[model samples]
Target: MTLLNVENLRVTFRTEAGPVEAVRGVSFNLGRERLGIVGESGSGKTITGRSVLRLIRPPGKILADRMEFDGIDLTRADEKTMRGLRGRRIAMIMQDPKYSLNPVMKVGAQLTEGLRQRDGMSAADARKKAIEALEAVQIRAPERVMEAYPHELSGGMGQRVMIAMMLIPGPDLLIADEPTSALDVTVQAEVLAILDGLVRDRGMGLIFISHDLRLVARFCDRVLVMYKGKIVEELAARDLMAAKHPYTQGLLNCLPRIGGSQGPLPSLDRDAAWAL
Candidate 1:
């Protein structure tokens, strides 16, 4: 199923210096599969994700030829319509749980808020589903963990909680922005496995945005490599090593190899023409 179709999507911000273009003519289609957008910090990766939900506020303008989700036009949807779609139909798992989670609220209370508001479930049912969500992410002692506040949990557990909260609403599409950036390898793998299982079993679409070339290539089905506000290369994730674009090659060369030459890794060579 084609869940999202975007064409010529552009994002610009009104900075004090002048108008700055963040995304330029970006276009792609997302189905019931994993799509990864890989880029450096200033490559407009986050802006692209925010633009999809019209999260870009005043002073930031979004213009698009077409942006549709499940055959509904997203670009023209009113605030009320977009609000209903944001958390219920399309969810976003942000990078850090420290900032995303409520520090004052209990884990269980925060997790069940969406269920109570959107699904209109009774308190007992919402709490039951909340525990199941925590277990789905393989959290041990979920009942104890639910009573603890967000500040008391470890980094890995906090991240898993964030994932559970996002998935509890049964969204059709999930946009995870650097969901595993701070975790150790073991925890990262565990989180990815949980996400993959849910996507496979429920047939949900995922848009994973990150800067790690190797991880994206291994974990995603297709990849869009962004540079200077444009997609420099698009290919199957398995073929990342064989990418032909010079920018893509430069990024691949920057990755360190084990037991290879001991010198520092190569630096990326930026070309002015590549942005065009």
Candidate 2:
């Protein structure tokens, strides 16, 4: 059931100030279940997800003792091999559809581009599949949405479109990087529901990266808490409140609970040792 296995994974960028390690010695195994990576900004959660798909470019280096996906060695995969795996076997849903989708292309074109180019699907067949994908995400009037451009859709609609596109290929693993960060609470719930359904129905492994500790705890099966470029703790989602790490405990205490604490939320008492 283990879809991915990563050990001592490191992602570093050759900056003007010398090498900066964004992800340091992060290791985890993912099965066909939701795995949440939670942390504040610059904590390397996003980098860790991208490293699995070998998306790090030059100047940004990825190193690992072992990085495998479905028995294939990701650390040693060439660009061509990685390309085949990406989208087809391992799809990634970025933070924002506005930035991820092409501005100039229509929604239908954007959705079917991969199908036609990579899968060698014919135009009519690709269009039919694209419409089905849109429908699967609960987008009503799929044909109309497909004809519209990215700018023409609302935030929630655009996000659903993104989810639909990623699911079109029926990937085994889905890495969602703050997929609901920009949406309102209602929209966030809907998006989470869609993702949850995919995991339950399709048996797809999910790597959900987010800064919202509460949301991650609610939606994910297991949680990995990251801080200063490394995993601080890993625990079941239901046990998040009872986490043993000070970092996790500090994060939980920082959340402003309604009707519970009218006082100022506590800030993290930074520990130098947490990073080490």
Give the alpha-carbon lDDT of every model.
0.93, 0.94
- Tell me the tens digit of each residue's lDDT in model 2 across 1-276: 899999999999999899999999999999999999999999999999999998888889999999999999998888899889999999999998899999999999999999999889999999999999998888889999999999999988998899999999999999999999988999889889999999999999999999999999999999999998999999999999899999999989988887886877899998999999
What's the CA error at residue 231 for candidate 2, in Å?
A: 0.5
Q: Write the per-residue lDDT of candidate 1 for residues 34-63, one digit (tens) a residue.
A: 999999999988899988889999889999
Off by over 4 Å in 1: none
For candidate 2, report its TM-score: 0.97
Number of the top lDDT candidate: 2
RMSD of each: 1.0, 1.0
TM-score to true structure, per model: 0.98, 0.97
Q: How many Å off is the CA of 235 in candidate 1?
A: 0.4
